[model samples]
Target: MSIGKKLANKTETVRGAAKKYLGRATGNTRLRTEGRLEQAKGNTKQAGAKAKDIFKR
Candidate 1:
């Protein structure tokens, strides 16, 4: 897990949040679900990367 992956995960999380809100405001269920999934994926990636870093130490 390199810094790039971590950064990407963080960025994805933020983007996902924005998308979620946008979806909510528009009442678009599909967008909302997509955003939620993206958020989860980002969180998972970040956690995995952190775990890898910890093990590396």
Candidate 2:
């Protein structure tokens, strides 16, 4: 994966974790669900980047 994409994915994952924690603390189901979705999005992006790298090779 490109460095920029890697960094962005990591940031997303971290932000998701933070949001999930905040949601849990505040008893907000919607925020917690959003956090889970964000984390999944980050993972999907990372997977796509890896696939691109493999195909480039």
lDDT value, candidate 1, whole model: 0.89
lDDT of 1 by residue, 1-57 (tens): 777878999999988888898899999988988899899889998998888889999
Q: Model 2, stretches more than 4 Å misplaced? A: none
| TM-score on alpha carbons, each prediction | 0.91, 0.83
Clashing pairs in 2: none
Off by over 4 Å in 1: none
Quantify all predictions' global Cα lDDT against the true fold. 0.89, 0.88
Positional deviation of residue 9's Cα in model 1 after best superposition, in angstroms = 0.9
lDDT for 19 (candidate 2) = 83
Q: Give the TM-score comparing model 2 with the true structure, all chains together.
A: 0.83
* lDDT (Cα, 0-100) at 47 in candidate 1: 90
| Candidate 1 lDDT score at position 10 | 97
